[model samples]
Target: MVPTLNAIRHSRRHLARWMRPQRRPVAWTFRPARAWIRYQPLGCIGIIAPWNYPLYLALAPLVDALAAGNRALIKPSEYTPRLAELLARVIGRAFAAEEVAVVTGGPDVAAAFASLPFDHLLFTGSTAIGRRVMAAAAANLTPVTLELGGKSPVIVGPDYGVRSAARSIAFGKFFNAGQTCVAPDYVLAPTHMVRPLAVALLREAQRAYPTVADNPDYTAMITERHHARLVAAIEAARAAGAEVLAHEDAGAAGLRKIGPTIVLAPPAGSLLMQEEIFGPVLPILPYDTIEAAIATVNAGDRPLALYCLTHDAALREAVLARTLSGGVTLNGTLLHVTQDGLPFGGVGPSGIGAYHGRAGFERFSHARGIFQPGRFNGLELVRPPYGFVARRIARLLIGR
Candidate 1:
């Protein structure tokens, strides 16, 4: 909610400047002509927000759409019905139906919403569902901006202190019970530091949330099914002989909660390693060399976010150069997305496009280039039949 409010303030502050036309330089051959890019709204926009961070994800993009001077229709996840209803009521009262509106329902309604012939569609969810939304929009040739999720990784440099890195990692992983899209999915630590890192992470988790079952500070899985899936993954890793550390028992069925848990060196094929563990489960893997650690990240689909904890300039440069992700937070985690100046989205499978501040405004608006020829018209000399003047001008421009 703070991020959403910040986005609103940012849009209000800079929208006028973003809407102004940008003057472009004219080429030497087109002297006295003028060129500029005019920013125009792309008519109606369709937004399909995910269940996690329902209010922020749903309204953040709407902030961009509105700032671009476009009407929008939002489809909030069914998992958050109450918030969806509240969004509908408040937005409906503030704006006319054609200006802005919210739609709430199950998968069918979502599907129908995606199929609408809006000028542009922006969907934030899993990669599998993003594909479906893109396909539905294909029928109308509607442009799409997909903010999807994948396994975001954290890398701890050899020189960085284990406890310091652990503190930040634990904060990112256990915040909202690790349900955040940009949370650290797993860690690649120096071989000798793996055990120490794991211990520190556990210590930090315990200090943060001493009790998980009834702790008001601790968050639960959004649904019972989500809770079950996380438990199954942890148990699968344990069955595969991975070392498991937990703040409490795996989880409580009634509470839909999973205590902060860490799996050390889970088998490569285990569910914990293969899927996006959108819960309080962090896996620590050992790497003898930083190059190998980087290769391991590149081995999978491009992730949405990457974190590198290193003060060394060369090591940080190497990691930055060799990796590809939607965004990177150096020596920290989850802070890159908070800045309104940066563009936030994925590349390859993780996501399609970016949106935030100026990027969001431009994504929802079209830049139409306009050019006006001068009254003298330099091109007139080169347009006639093969005459001496035309030949001379061509030689001067193109060079013999």
Candidate 2:
């Protein structure tokens, strides 16, 4: 909610600048003619938000749509119905129904919402669901912006301190119990530092939440099924010969909480390695050299975010050059997305387009090109009624 409010404030602060027309260059042949791009609203935008950070994901895009001068219809995830209802009530009181509205329901309703002939659609969720939303939107030939999730990786360069990297990783991974889409999904560290990094991560996690089961600061999985899935993945990694380190147990059943865990060198085929571990489970993989680490990251689908813990300029530049992700936070984690100036979205499978502040405004607005020609146009010399002058001008323009 705080982040969403911040986004709203950002939009308000920059709305005027974003709405102004941008000047474009005119060709030499079109002297005295001016060109510019007019930013116009897309009319209506459809937002399909996810369960995690429901309020922020749903309203942040709406902030952009509104700043772009477009009406919006939001469909909040079924998992967060109460908040959805609250949002509907608040928006209803604040704006006319035609201006802004919220719809709440299950997958069926979400599907129907996606099929609407909106001017543009933005969906934030898992890649599987993003695919379905895009297909539904295709029926209307509506443009879409997909903010999907993937296995975001962290690379701890040899030049950086393992302990420092571990602290940042632990904070990001356990912030929402690792429910965040941009959380560090796994770590690639020097082979010798793998165990040290894992130990440091556990120490940091313990310091943050001494008691995971009953601590108010520590969050639980959103659903029982999600908790079970995480547990199964941890067990699968352990069964596959990976060394597992876990914080104290949750102490009872049905708490829907799994203690923070670290899996060391999980096999390539293990569940922890195969899927995005959107939980408080950190996997540390060993890489002998930076080249090998880059190779490993490139082997997977392009991640949504990438973290490189290094102060060495060359090493950072090499990693930046070799890898592709939606965004990056150097020597830290999850801070890149908070920057209102930076565009946030993934490339390839991670996401389709970017949005935040001005980027968001531009995403929801159309760049209509406009031109004004002077009364004395130079192109008149090459008119259709060919004469000596016209032929000469045409030959000169066309290079003889």
Candidate 3:
């Protein structure tokens, strides 16, 4: 609810400015020419939203398409049936069928929607699904913006003490029951601070949810299958010699809730370390040096976001330079994506293309470069073939 409202306020505040033409200075050779890049609508856009943050993700892109003067067709996830139906109802009332419409469906319908030849397509989901969507879009030569999830990592700087960092990591990791794409999947802790950080993480979880077993504040995993996957992963990690610390009771079978679980030195081959634990489980890896931590992260697929908790300028700069992620949050977590001015998206396997603020408008709108030739131009001088003036101008312009 909070993020949805914030996105609306942000889009309204800046949409007009982003629509204005950006007049550019012509090159020295093209003096007296009028040049500008105009933001033009791409007609119709298709938005395939994910189940997590179902309402916000579906609406956020739709708002951008409308703001850019483009009609939109939204395909809301079938997982959230009730919300999807409500969205379809509300959108149908607010917009003409051609201008904005919602389609609720499962995988087959999604695949059909993805193959549509819209002016542009935006997909938010897993990397595998994003690939299929892109492939379908490619047949029509349609442009696409993919927002996918991956295992984001948090590296704790040596100078920063364990307690504050642990609390922030726990909050970000456990928020939305860790189903969030940007949630920290694991932590790279300093060698001497690994145990202390684990302890602090458990302490913070306990402090936040005193009775997590029955606490209303603690969120349940998105579904029964997701719950089973997390539990099985945890059990696998335990079998692989990883120590697990539960801040509160692990609820009985059939309950979706899983207490905040802290893992210490889980084997790299274990399921918990191998996959994106989109549950309230965080694995901490001890590193003797900052280089080791950075290397460990860079070796894997580029993450959606990277976090470091530290006040040291040198340490911050070092991490910022050596590591690669779509976004970075220093001394905090998950707050970077909330900034309205910055572009929000992932890089490499995490995602392709960006949105939010002016970026969202530009992503949906094509920047048509307009060039009106000047009265006394060199273009005419260089147009004729084999003439002295044309030859001279060609030589001068082409530097041959």
Which of the two, 1 or 3, has more lDDT?
Answer: 1
lDDT of 1: 0.93
Give candidate 2's root-mean-square deviation (CA, Å). 1.1
Worst 10 residues of 3 by lDDT: 246-255
Candidate 3 lDDT over 3-62, as tens digits, reads 667877888888878888899888878877899999999999999998888988988888
Off by over 4 Å in 1: 249-251, 384-386
Native-to-model Cα distance after best TM-score fit, residue 55 in candidate 3, in Å = 1.3
- Shift of residue 159 alpha carbon in model 3, Å: 1.3
The candidate, 1 or 3, that scores higher on TM-score is 1
Ranking by TM-score: 2, 1, 3
Q: For every model shown, what is its TM-score relative to the native structure? A: 0.97, 0.98, 0.96
Residue 324, model 1: Cα distance from true site in angstroms: 0.7
Candidate 2, residues 1-400, lDDT tens digits: the string is 7778889889889898888899999988898999999999999999999988988899899989999999999999999999999999999999999999999999999999999999999999999999999999999999999999899999999888977988899988999899999999999999989999999999999999888878888888999989999989988888888999999764723688888899999999888998998999999999998999999999999999999999899999999999999999999999999888889999999999999999999999999999999888978777778889898878888889
Evaluate residue 314 in candidate 1 and report its C-alpha lDDT on the 0 to 100 scale. Answer: 93
Off by over 4 Å in 2: 250-253
Separately for all candidates shown, the number of backbone clashes (residues 3 or more apart, or on different chains) is: 0, 0, 0
